[model samples]
Target: MSAEKTPGISAIDTTNFARQIVLDFEFAPVPKQRQRRGLRNEIIEVGAVKLDYHGNVMGEFSQFVQTEYTEGVAYPVRELTGISAVDTAMAGPLYVVIKRLSDWIGRYSAQVVCWSGADRRQLLTECQAKHIDPAAFPTDWADLQTFYTSIMDVGSHGCVSLSDAATWFGIEFDESTGHAHSALADARVTAKLLKQVMDGDYRVSPRAQEIRQRWGGWASEPRRAFPRSAPS
Candidate 1:
Protein backbone atom coordinates (compact mmCIF):
# COMPACT_ATOMS: atom_id res chain seq x y z
CA MET A 1 0.00 0.00 0.00
CA SER A 2 1.15 3.51 -0.75
CA ALA A 3 2.17 5.69 2.14
CA GLU A 4 0.47 8.64 0.54
CA LYS A 5 -2.77 9.84 2.11
CA THR A 6 -5.57 12.08 0.94
CA PRO A 7 -7.09 14.89 2.97
CA GLY A 8 -9.20 13.15 5.61
CA ILE A 9 -9.25 9.67 4.15
CA SER A 10 -6.56 7.06 4.21
CA ALA A 11 -4.15 6.75 1.32
CA ILE A 12 -6.02 6.55 -1.97
CA ASP A 13 -4.31 3.31 -2.93
CA THR A 14 -5.84 2.28 -6.20
CA THR A 15 -3.75 -0.87 -6.15
CA ASN A 16 -4.99 -1.91 -2.74
CA PHE A 17 -8.59 -1.13 -3.58
CA ALA A 18 -8.44 -3.16 -6.78
CA ARG A 19 -7.31 -6.23 -4.89
CA GLN A 20 -10.40 -6.10 -2.67
CA ILE A 21 -13.69 -7.88 -3.09
CA VAL A 22 -16.00 -6.21 -5.59
CA LEU A 23 -19.68 -6.66 -4.84
CA ASP A 24 -23.11 -5.86 -6.26
CA PHE A 25 -26.77 -6.28 -5.36
CA GLU A 26 -30.04 -6.60 -7.24
CA PHE A 27 -33.09 -5.51 -5.29
CA ALA A 28 -36.76 -5.92 -6.07
CA PRO A 29 -39.23 -3.24 -5.15
CA VAL A 30 -42.40 -4.19 -3.34
CA PRO A 31 -45.40 -4.64 -5.59
CA LYS A 32 -47.15 -1.36 -6.26
CA GLN A 33 -50.46 -2.81 -5.18
CA ARG A 34 -49.33 -2.78 -1.57
CA GLN A 35 -50.32 0.36 0.25
CA ARG A 36 -47.76 -0.54 2.93
CA ARG A 37 -44.33 -2.02 2.25
CA GLY A 38 -41.86 -3.75 4.46
CA LEU A 39 -38.62 -2.62 2.84
CA ARG A 40 -38.57 -0.12 0.05
CA ASN A 41 -36.26 -2.12 -2.19
CA GLU A 42 -35.91 -5.65 -0.86
CA ILE A 43 -32.70 -7.37 -1.87
CA ILE A 44 -33.34 -10.33 -4.14
CA GLU A 45 -29.76 -11.13 -5.11
CA VAL A 46 -26.25 -10.67 -3.71
CA GLY A 47 -23.10 -11.15 -5.76
CA ALA A 48 -19.40 -10.60 -5.27
CA VAL A 49 -16.07 -11.23 -6.99
CA LYS A 50 -12.94 -11.19 -4.89
CA LEU A 51 -9.61 -10.32 -6.49
CA ASP A 52 -6.02 -11.03 -5.54
CA TYR A 53 -3.31 -8.37 -5.26
CA HIS A 54 -2.54 -8.85 -8.94
CA GLY A 55 -6.16 -8.16 -9.84
CA ASN A 56 -6.91 -11.76 -10.80
CA VAL A 57 -10.23 -13.19 -9.72
CA MET A 58 -9.75 -15.33 -6.62
CA GLY A 59 -13.29 -16.39 -5.86
CA GLU A 60 -16.93 -15.40 -6.18
CA PHE A 61 -20.26 -15.43 -4.34
CA SER A 62 -23.77 -15.24 -5.72
CA GLN A 63 -27.18 -16.07 -4.32
CA PHE A 64 -30.85 -15.31 -4.79
CA VAL A 65 -32.25 -13.99 -1.53
CA GLN A 66 -35.83 -14.48 -0.43
CA THR A 67 -37.68 -11.40 0.65
CA GLU A 68 -40.64 -11.00 2.98
CA TYR A 69 -42.81 -9.62 0.20
CA THR A 70 -46.08 -11.55 0.17
CA GLU A 71 -47.08 -10.10 -3.17
CA GLY A 72 -44.50 -12.24 -4.94
CA VAL A 73 -42.23 -10.64 -7.47
CA ALA A 74 -43.48 -7.49 -9.14
CA TYR A 75 -44.06 -7.70 -12.87
CA PRO A 76 -41.65 -4.88 -13.62
CA VAL A 77 -38.95 -6.34 -11.42
CA ARG A 78 -39.29 -9.71 -13.07
CA GLU A 79 -39.06 -8.08 -16.47
CA LEU A 80 -36.04 -6.00 -15.50
CA THR A 81 -34.03 -8.48 -13.43
CA GLY A 82 -35.38 -11.63 -15.01
CA ILE A 83 -35.73 -12.91 -11.48
CA SER A 84 -39.20 -14.23 -10.99
CA ALA A 85 -41.00 -14.75 -7.69
CA VAL A 86 -40.51 -18.47 -8.02
CA ASP A 87 -36.75 -18.02 -8.28
CA THR A 88 -36.59 -16.37 -4.90
CA ALA A 89 -39.44 -18.42 -3.42
CA MET A 90 -37.20 -21.23 -2.21
CA ALA A 91 -34.03 -19.16 -1.74
CA GLY A 92 -32.56 -18.39 1.64
CA PRO A 93 -33.75 -15.41 3.68
CA LEU A 94 -31.99 -12.07 3.54
CA TYR A 95 -30.45 -12.52 7.00
CA VAL A 96 -29.13 -15.93 6.13
CA VAL A 97 -27.63 -14.74 2.87
CA ILE A 98 -26.12 -11.77 4.61
CA LYS A 99 -24.54 -14.05 7.20
CA ARG A 100 -23.05 -16.28 4.54
CA LEU A 101 -21.73 -13.29 2.62
CA SER A 102 -20.27 -11.85 5.77
CA ASP A 103 -18.38 -15.06 6.45
CA TRP A 104 -17.08 -15.17 2.91
CA ILE A 105 -15.90 -11.56 2.97
CA GLY A 106 -14.56 -11.68 6.51
CA ARG A 107 -11.83 -14.04 5.39
CA TYR A 108 -10.10 -11.24 3.54
CA SER A 109 -8.25 -8.06 4.52
CA ALA A 110 -9.34 -6.19 1.43
CA GLN A 111 -11.70 -3.40 0.52
CA VAL A 112 -15.05 -3.54 -1.33
CA VAL A 113 -15.69 -2.11 -4.78
CA CYS A 114 -18.79 -1.30 -6.80
CA TRP A 115 -19.79 0.77 -9.80
CA SER A 116 -21.70 3.15 -7.57
CA GLY A 117 -22.72 3.78 -4.00
CA ALA A 118 -26.18 2.30 -4.44
CA ASP A 119 -25.12 -1.25 -3.54
CA ARG A 120 -23.36 -0.15 -0.36
CA ARG A 121 -26.32 1.93 0.69
CA GLN A 122 -28.70 -0.92 0.03
CA LEU A 123 -26.59 -3.34 2.05
CA LEU A 124 -26.49 -0.93 4.96
CA THR A 125 -30.24 -0.34 4.92
CA GLU A 126 -31.08 -4.03 4.64
CA CYS A 127 -28.68 -5.00 7.39
CA GLN A 128 -30.03 -2.28 9.65
CA ALA A 129 -33.64 -3.38 9.10
CA LYS A 130 -32.72 -7.00 9.76
CA HIS A 131 -30.70 -6.05 12.85
CA ILE A 132 -27.58 -7.59 11.25
CA ASP A 133 -24.31 -6.09 12.39
CA PRO A 134 -23.11 -3.77 9.68
CA ALA A 135 -19.59 -3.70 11.11
CA ALA A 136 -18.65 -6.88 9.27
CA PHE A 137 -18.54 -4.94 6.01
CA PRO A 138 -15.11 -3.79 4.84
CA THR A 139 -14.47 -0.18 5.74
CA ASP A 140 -12.55 0.63 2.58
CA TRP A 141 -14.27 0.94 -0.79
CA ALA A 142 -13.81 2.44 -4.24
CA ASP A 143 -16.61 3.92 -6.32
CA LEU A 144 -15.68 3.02 -9.92
CA GLN A 145 -17.80 5.81 -11.40
CA THR A 146 -15.91 8.44 -9.49
CA PHE A 147 -12.59 6.85 -10.33
CA TYR A 148 -13.44 6.36 -13.99
CA THR A 149 -14.47 9.98 -14.34
CA SER A 150 -11.19 11.00 -12.82
CA ILE A 151 -8.93 8.68 -14.81
CA MET A 152 -10.48 9.45 -18.16
CA ASP A 153 -10.26 13.17 -17.32
CA VAL A 154 -13.96 13.33 -18.12
CA GLY A 155 -16.17 15.83 -16.41
CA SER A 156 -19.24 14.82 -14.44
CA HIS A 157 -21.46 14.40 -17.48
CA GLY A 158 -18.93 12.04 -19.02
CA CYS A 159 -19.43 9.49 -16.28
CA VAL A 160 -20.08 6.14 -17.95
CA SER A 161 -22.60 3.44 -17.05
CA LEU A 162 -21.44 -0.11 -16.28
CA SER A 163 -22.00 -1.42 -19.80
CA ASP A 164 -20.34 1.66 -21.21
CA ALA A 165 -17.43 1.16 -18.88
CA ALA A 166 -17.01 -2.39 -20.14
CA THR A 167 -16.88 -1.14 -23.71
CA TRP A 168 -14.30 1.47 -22.79
CA PHE A 169 -12.13 -1.21 -21.23
CA GLY A 170 -12.48 -3.43 -24.31
CA ILE A 171 -14.07 -6.21 -22.33
CA GLU A 172 -17.09 -7.99 -23.74
CA PHE A 173 -20.21 -7.88 -21.62
CA ASP A 174 -20.94 -11.48 -20.73
CA GLU A 175 -24.53 -12.38 -21.60
CA SER A 176 -24.52 -15.41 -19.31
CA THR A 177 -24.85 -13.21 -16.23
CA GLY A 178 -28.62 -13.32 -16.93
CA HIS A 179 -29.14 -9.86 -18.42
CA ALA A 180 -27.82 -6.54 -17.11
CA HIS A 181 -29.37 -6.82 -13.67
CA SER A 182 -27.66 -10.05 -12.78
CA ALA A 183 -25.70 -9.17 -9.66
CA LEU A 184 -22.88 -11.64 -10.31
CA ALA A 185 -22.48 -10.55 -13.90
CA ASP A 186 -22.42 -6.93 -12.91
CA ALA A 187 -19.88 -7.63 -10.19
CA ARG A 188 -17.66 -9.46 -12.63
CA VAL A 189 -17.75 -6.52 -14.99
CA THR A 190 -16.95 -4.14 -12.17
CA ALA A 191 -13.96 -6.30 -11.24
CA LYS A 192 -12.59 -6.04 -14.77
CA LEU A 193 -12.85 -2.26 -14.68
CA LEU A 194 -11.11 -2.22 -11.34
CA LYS A 195 -8.24 -4.16 -12.86
CA GLN A 196 -7.90 -1.64 -15.65
CA VAL A 197 -7.85 1.28 -13.25
CA MET A 198 -5.34 -0.39 -10.96
CA ASP A 199 -3.05 -1.33 -13.81
CA GLY A 200 -2.68 2.37 -14.55
CA ASP A 201 -1.72 5.40 -12.47
CA TYR A 202 -5.11 7.11 -12.80
CA ARG A 203 -6.25 9.42 -10.05
CA VAL A 204 -9.46 11.37 -9.62
CA SER A 205 -9.22 14.50 -11.72
CA PRO A 206 -9.72 17.96 -10.29
CA ARG A 207 -13.10 18.05 -12.05
CA ALA A 208 -14.16 15.38 -9.58
CA GLN A 209 -14.40 18.15 -6.99
CA GLU A 210 -17.53 19.44 -8.69
CA ILE A 211 -19.13 16.02 -8.77
CA ARG A 212 -18.26 15.32 -5.14
CA GLN A 213 -19.70 18.67 -4.14
CA ARG A 214 -23.01 17.74 -5.71
CA TRP A 215 -23.09 14.67 -3.47
CA GLY A 216 -22.41 16.96 -0.46
CA GLY A 217 -18.64 16.32 -0.18
CA TRP A 218 -15.91 13.77 -0.62
CA ALA A 219 -17.01 10.63 1.23
CA SER A 220 -15.48 10.46 4.67
CA GLU A 221 -12.49 8.18 5.10
CA PRO A 222 -13.15 4.51 5.79
CA ARG A 223 -16.45 5.87 4.55
CA ARG A 224 -19.15 6.36 7.20
CA ALA A 225 -19.92 3.35 9.40
CA PHE A 226 -23.04 3.26 7.22
CA PRO A 227 -24.54 5.42 4.53
CA ARG A 228 -27.80 7.24 5.19
CA SER A 229 -30.72 4.81 4.92
CA ALA A 230 -31.34 4.00 1.26
CA PRO A 231 -34.05 5.97 -0.52
CA SER A 232 -37.62 4.88 0.11
Candidate 2:
Protein backbone atom coordinates (compact mmCIF):
# COMPACT_ATOMS: atom_id res chain seq x y z
CA MET A 1 0.00 0.00 0.00
CA SER A 2 1.33 3.45 -0.86
CA ALA A 3 1.56 6.09 1.88
CA GLU A 4 -0.28 8.39 -0.52
CA LYS A 5 -3.47 6.36 -0.12
CA THR A 6 -5.39 5.92 3.14
CA PRO A 7 -6.98 2.60 3.95
CA GLY A 8 -10.75 1.94 3.67
CA ILE A 9 -11.31 5.19 1.76
CA SER A 10 -9.20 4.06 -1.17
CA ALA A 11 -11.26 1.39 -2.94
CA ILE A 12 -8.57 0.85 -5.57
CA ASP A 13 -6.35 -0.97 -3.08
CA THR A 14 -8.33 -4.07 -4.20
CA THR A 15 -6.58 -6.13 -1.52
CA ASN A 16 -8.68 -4.46 1.23
CA PHE A 17 -12.28 -3.43 0.85
CA ALA A 18 -15.73 -4.08 2.35
CA ARG A 19 -14.54 -3.61 5.96
CA GLN A 20 -16.50 -1.51 8.45
CA ILE A 21 -14.94 1.28 10.51
CA VAL A 22 -14.58 0.92 14.27
CA LEU A 23 -12.07 1.73 17.03
CA ASP A 24 -10.63 -0.76 19.54
CA PHE A 25 -8.83 -0.06 22.84
CA GLU A 26 -6.63 -2.05 25.28
CA PHE A 27 -4.69 -1.15 28.44
CA ALA A 28 -1.95 -2.67 30.54
CA PRO A 29 -0.23 -2.05 33.88
CA VAL A 30 2.22 0.79 34.35
CA PRO A 31 5.91 -0.11 34.71
CA LYS A 32 7.20 -0.65 38.20
CA GLN A 33 4.79 0.51 40.88
CA ARG A 34 3.00 3.77 41.11
CA GLN A 35 -0.64 3.24 42.16
CA ARG A 36 -4.19 3.95 41.14
CA ARG A 37 -7.48 3.53 42.94
CA GLY A 38 -9.28 1.69 40.16
CA LEU A 39 -8.22 -0.95 37.67
CA ARG A 40 -9.33 1.31 34.81
CA ASN A 41 -6.87 4.09 35.55
CA GLU A 42 -3.62 2.25 34.93
CA ILE A 43 -3.85 2.05 31.16
CA ILE A 44 -0.31 1.46 29.85
CA GLU A 45 -1.13 1.37 26.13
CA VAL A 46 -3.79 1.91 23.42
CA GLY A 47 -4.43 0.58 19.90
CA ALA A 48 -6.94 0.71 17.01
CA VAL A 49 -7.82 -0.69 13.54
CA LYS A 50 -9.77 0.69 10.56
CA LEU A 51 -12.26 -1.21 8.45
CA ASP A 52 -14.40 0.05 5.60
CA TYR A 53 -18.22 -0.08 5.67
CA HIS A 54 -18.06 -3.45 3.91
CA GLY A 55 -16.22 -5.48 6.63
CA ASN A 56 -12.74 -5.65 5.10
CA VAL A 57 -9.91 -4.75 7.44
CA MET A 58 -8.29 -1.80 5.71
CA GLY A 59 -5.38 -0.96 7.98
CA GLU A 60 -4.33 -0.45 11.57
CA PHE A 61 -3.12 2.13 14.15
CA SER A 62 -1.48 1.59 17.53
CA GLN A 63 0.35 3.38 20.34
CA PHE A 64 2.30 2.46 23.44
CA VAL A 65 2.03 5.49 25.68
CA GLN A 66 4.29 6.37 28.62
CA THR A 67 2.82 7.75 31.78
CA GLU A 68 3.59 9.05 35.28
CA TYR A 69 0.37 8.34 37.21
CA THR A 70 -0.21 4.58 36.88
CA GLU A 71 1.75 1.89 38.65
CA GLY A 72 3.95 -0.30 36.43
CA VAL A 73 3.72 -3.71 38.05
CA ALA A 74 2.32 -7.18 37.59
CA TYR A 75 -1.45 -7.07 37.64
CA PRO A 76 -4.35 -9.16 36.35
CA VAL A 77 -4.34 -7.05 33.17
CA ARG A 78 -0.81 -8.13 32.19
CA GLU A 79 -1.88 -11.78 32.23
CA LEU A 80 -4.85 -10.91 30.04
CA THR A 81 -3.24 -8.51 27.54
CA GLY A 82 0.53 -9.21 27.80
CA ILE A 83 1.22 -5.49 27.63
CA SER A 84 4.43 -4.20 29.23
CA ALA A 85 5.90 -0.73 29.42
CA VAL A 86 8.81 -1.87 27.29
CA ASP A 87 6.57 -3.03 24.44
CA THR A 88 3.80 -0.47 25.00
CA ALA A 89 6.01 2.62 24.61
CA MET A 90 7.05 1.48 21.16
CA ALA A 91 3.57 2.30 19.77
CA GLY A 92 3.97 6.06 20.33
CA PRO A 93 2.35 8.92 22.22
CA LEU A 94 -1.33 9.53 23.05
CA TYR A 95 -1.29 12.80 21.12
CA VAL A 96 0.07 11.11 18.02
CA VAL A 97 -2.33 8.19 18.41
CA ILE A 98 -5.33 10.36 19.21
CA LYS A 99 -4.64 12.71 16.34
CA ARG A 100 -4.42 9.76 14.00
CA LEU A 101 -7.60 8.40 15.53
CA SER A 102 -9.45 11.64 14.83
CA ASP A 103 -8.22 11.67 11.28
CA TRP A 104 -9.29 8.07 10.84
CA ILE A 105 -12.75 8.48 12.29
CA GLY A 106 -13.53 11.24 9.79
CA ARG A 107 -17.29 12.02 9.90
CA TYR A 108 -19.63 10.26 12.37
CA SER A 109 -21.35 8.47 9.42
CA ALA A 110 -20.87 5.16 11.39
CA GLN A 111 -21.32 4.01 14.97
CA VAL A 112 -18.70 2.74 17.46
CA VAL A 113 -19.14 -0.56 19.27
CA CYS A 114 -16.70 -1.15 22.11
CA TRP A 115 -15.84 -4.20 24.25
CA SER A 116 -16.41 -2.18 27.39
CA GLY A 117 -18.84 0.66 27.85
CA ALA A 118 -16.27 2.45 29.96
CA ASP A 119 -14.05 3.03 26.91
CA ARG A 120 -15.66 6.41 26.41
CA ARG A 121 -14.86 7.41 29.95
CA GLN A 122 -11.26 6.21 29.71
CA LEU A 123 -10.66 7.83 26.31
CA LEU A 124 -12.11 11.09 27.50
CA THR A 125 -9.94 10.87 30.60
CA GLU A 126 -6.86 10.63 28.41
CA CYS A 127 -8.00 13.58 26.36
CA GLN A 128 -8.67 15.65 29.47
CA ALA A 129 -5.29 14.85 30.96
CA LYS A 130 -3.69 16.03 27.73
CA HIS A 131 -5.83 19.19 27.63
CA ILE A 132 -7.39 18.04 24.37
CA ASP A 133 -11.11 18.26 23.72
CA PRO A 134 -12.76 14.89 24.18
CA ALA A 135 -15.91 16.05 22.47
CA ALA A 136 -14.01 16.18 19.22
CA PHE A 137 -15.02 12.57 18.60
CA PRO A 138 -18.55 11.52 17.88
CA THR A 139 -21.03 11.80 20.72
CA ASP A 140 -23.06 9.03 19.03
CA TRP A 141 -20.79 6.11 19.90
CA ALA A 142 -22.35 3.07 21.66
CA ASP A 143 -20.92 0.17 23.66
CA LEU A 144 -21.36 -3.57 23.05
CA GLN A 145 -22.00 -3.98 26.76
CA THR A 146 -25.33 -2.32 26.22
CA PHE A 147 -26.24 -5.04 23.74
CA TYR A 148 -24.72 -7.95 25.74
CA THR A 149 -26.26 -6.91 29.04
CA SER A 150 -29.70 -6.69 27.52
CA ILE A 151 -29.30 -10.09 25.86
CA MET A 152 -27.36 -12.18 28.41
CA ASP A 153 -28.58 -10.86 31.74
CA VAL A 154 -26.92 -13.67 33.67
CA GLY A 155 -24.35 -11.58 35.53
CA SER A 156 -21.54 -12.08 32.98
CA HIS A 157 -19.35 -15.15 32.45
CA GLY A 158 -17.07 -16.81 35.00
CA CYS A 159 -14.01 -15.22 33.40
CA VAL A 160 -15.76 -11.84 33.37
CA SER A 161 -13.95 -11.12 30.11
CA LEU A 162 -15.13 -9.89 26.73
CA SER A 163 -15.18 -11.99 23.56
CA ASP A 164 -15.83 -11.22 19.94
CA ALA A 165 -19.29 -12.64 19.48
CA ALA A 166 -18.34 -12.93 15.80
CA THR A 167 -15.27 -15.04 16.60
CA TRP A 168 -17.34 -17.20 18.91
CA PHE A 169 -19.80 -17.78 16.08
CA GLY A 170 -17.00 -19.11 13.94
CA ILE A 171 -16.39 -22.87 14.26
CA GLU A 172 -12.92 -22.24 15.71
CA PHE A 173 -11.31 -19.11 17.08
CA ASP A 174 -8.32 -17.81 15.11
CA GLU A 175 -5.53 -18.45 17.59
CA SER A 176 -2.95 -17.20 15.08
CA THR A 177 -4.40 -13.75 15.69
CA GLY A 178 -2.63 -14.17 19.00
CA HIS A 179 -4.11 -13.25 22.37
CA ALA A 180 -6.94 -10.70 22.16
CA HIS A 181 -5.67 -8.25 24.76
CA SER A 182 -4.12 -5.42 22.79
CA ALA A 183 -6.36 -2.36 22.52
CA LEU A 184 -6.53 -2.57 18.72
CA ALA A 185 -7.04 -6.32 18.86
CA ASP A 186 -9.84 -5.91 21.33
CA ALA A 187 -11.35 -3.17 19.19
CA ARG A 188 -11.16 -5.28 16.06
CA VAL A 189 -12.72 -8.25 17.82
CA THR A 190 -15.54 -6.15 19.15
CA ALA A 191 -16.08 -4.80 15.67
CA LYS A 192 -16.30 -8.39 14.47
CA LEU A 193 -18.77 -9.17 17.22
CA LEU A 194 -20.92 -6.35 16.00
CA LYS A 195 -20.85 -8.02 12.59
CA GLN A 196 -21.99 -11.31 14.09
CA VAL A 197 -24.82 -9.69 15.96
CA MET A 198 -26.07 -8.17 12.75
CA ASP A 199 -25.80 -11.51 10.98
CA GLY A 200 -29.28 -12.46 12.26
CA ASP A 201 -27.79 -15.55 13.93
CA TYR A 202 -28.14 -14.02 17.40
CA ARG A 203 -31.21 -12.63 19.14
CA VAL A 204 -30.88 -9.01 20.23
CA SER A 205 -33.43 -6.35 21.10
CA PRO A 206 -35.29 -5.09 18.05
CA ARG A 207 -33.89 -1.63 18.68
CA ALA A 208 -30.30 -2.82 18.38
CA GLN A 209 -30.08 -1.28 14.89
CA GLU A 210 -27.73 1.33 16.34
CA ILE A 211 -25.27 -1.37 17.29
CA ARG A 212 -25.64 -2.97 13.89
CA GLN A 213 -24.87 0.30 12.15
CA ARG A 214 -21.58 0.42 14.00
CA TRP A 215 -20.47 -3.01 12.82
CA GLY A 216 -22.43 -3.74 9.68
CA GLY A 217 -20.28 -3.62 6.56
CA TRP A 218 -21.88 -1.89 3.60
CA ALA A 219 -22.43 -5.25 1.95
CA SER A 220 -24.12 -6.71 5.02
CA GLU A 221 -27.84 -6.98 4.62
CA PRO A 222 -29.99 -5.34 7.27
CA ARG A 223 -31.93 -7.62 9.56
CA ARG A 224 -35.70 -7.58 9.32
CA ALA A 225 -36.25 -7.99 13.07
CA PHE A 226 -34.57 -4.75 14.00
CA PRO A 227 -36.87 -2.11 15.50
CA ARG A 228 -36.56 1.45 14.35
CA SER A 229 -34.84 3.86 16.75
CA ALA A 230 -37.12 6.28 18.59
CA PRO A 231 -37.18 9.80 17.29
CA SER A 232 -34.79 12.07 19.15
1-232 per-residue lDDT for model 1 (tens digits): 2211222223234443435788888887765564242357878988899877666788899999998754577788888888888879989998888778878876557777777777767776667766777676676765766655444433434555786556544555566444577889888888877776556423333444544465454532121111222112
Give me the overall lDDT of model 2: 0.50
Please report the TM-score between candidate 2 and the true structure.
0.62
Which 10 consecutive positions of candidate 1 have the poorest summed lDDT? 221-230
Kindly report which residue pairs in candidate 1 clash with one another. none
Clashes per model (N, Cα, C within 3 A)? 0, 21
lDDT of 1 at 61: 98
Tens-digit lDDT track of model 2 for 11-99:
11212223345566665544335433333464566556565544456666666665546545355866777776566545556666666
TM-scores of the models, in the order given: 0.73, 0.62
- The candidate that achieves the highest TM-score relative to the unseen native structure: 1
Q: After superposition, how far is residue 169 of candidate 2 from its true place, in Å?
A: 3.0
**lDDT: which candidate is best?**
1
